[model samples]
Target: SRYPNDLARYPNARITFEHNQGIRERRKMRVNGNLLSSYQRQTVCLLGGVLQSEVSGMSLKLESPDKQVVQVIMKKPIEEPLEGLLEVVGEVTAKLAVVCHGYVLFPPGMSQNFDMETYNRLVELMNERKEHYPTMASC
Candidate 1:
């Protein structure tokens, strides 16, 4: 009944819903400082500790899970005071800097218990097994 014309033309034909693959492909992939250059110009999610902020509040230094420090440039002046750990959604530039589109600040005290080395290992594992885990491949 959904496709009345198609049903009328072929009464015995089966109808099935097809998912749009493009939607899943558009999700931002998670990456660390070491992986930034490889995903240049691509939108991605990066989690890091805030090392320093510029006086203009348009940029800051982020220490990635791998202990590499990279610059993060915001599309707009930062409205909130940045501290501790933050997750940035942005595109990687040619210079390996992240041009932030948006970001999420972790709650106070959360960073004290966070383990960077373990998280880095997990990221590497997910990337290595991307083919086997279709959902994680997008992260």
Candidate 2:
């Protein structure tokens, strides 16, 4: 029953199973190959928990592969009320991918809006915490 050798004589079944299976196999191979290539190129960075605020957006720490630590704090001013604050934060976090090896990776049409002062304070804070995580290279 599983083999369905009897259906092999039908042209429609052959087209549905054989031709489609070939396409599916090719697609799977392409997907697996792409995944392998991406794994080889990209370094895995540890994204820490996000600390949210009402005035500003959200603040989260990213530990790069090189052991450097930097906080990816958002610099958006809250113009609207807290109606869709969560949605806004979600959108930002989804699009924002910080590369811990040393920098942030912005998607196409996206630009940096980082708060330098906050980053400086974060650097100081990270330095203070370095006493606990001696292995980490915090900025």
Candidate 3:
């Protein structure tokens, strides 16, 4: 009934509908340290090695796979000692720092032989071709 004549004309055509909940959700993009400035004010996901952590200050330093380091300001003080590789999800600030919403810590030795350069390349490719990746597409 919604498309009476059109559905009859294209009998085999498939129709897909998307529902919006009236809330705008920002999509998180995977990024490296060097690309932080470009995504200022936007939320992003960063994978890096924990360089240093200041629990008192609620901040920490991370070194990306590309070897670029950046500061991450946490929403709350760290409750545990963070080490090894960490994946931080947060919004980027004007000063090129991330205000972390949450993080995941990879177990030690897991990242001991991790190849960062290749991973960084993959991130770049995914961002460059967001349309090809359904998860990355805005739609």
Task: Give Cα distance to truth, residue 4, candidate 1, Å.
Answer: 39
Instruction: Score residue 110 of candidate 1 by CA lDDT.
Output: 66
**Which of 1 and 2 is ahead in TM-score?**
1
Candidate 1 lDDT over 1-139, as tens digits, reads 5333523543433222224344235666677788888788887778889999998989999999988898999767876678887777777995559887666566555667789889888777766776764431212
Ranking by lDDT: 3, 1, 2
Looking at candidate 2, the ten consecutive residues that score lowest on lDDT are: 83-92
In model 3, which regions exceed 4 Å deviation? 1-26, 55-57, 134-139
- Clash count for each candidate, listed in order shown: 1, 1, 0
Computed on alpha carbons, the lDDT of every model, listed in order, comes to 0.71, 0.27, 0.71
Give candidate 3's whole-model lDDT: 0.71
Off by over 4 Å in 1: 1-25, 135-139
How far residue 70's Cα lies from its native spot in candidate 3, in Å, is 0.6
Against the true structure, candidate 1 has what lDDT? 0.71
Q: Which pairs clash (backbone N, Cα, C closer than 3 Å) in model 3?
A: none
C-alpha RMSD (angstroms) for model 3: 12.7
Per-residue C-alpha lDDT of model 2 across residues 6-72, encoded as one tens digit per residue: 3334322211122223322221111111122332323222322223333453443443222333344
Model 1 RMSD in Å is 13.4
TM-score per candidate, chains pooled: 0.75, 0.20, 0.74
Clashing pairs in 1: 30-139
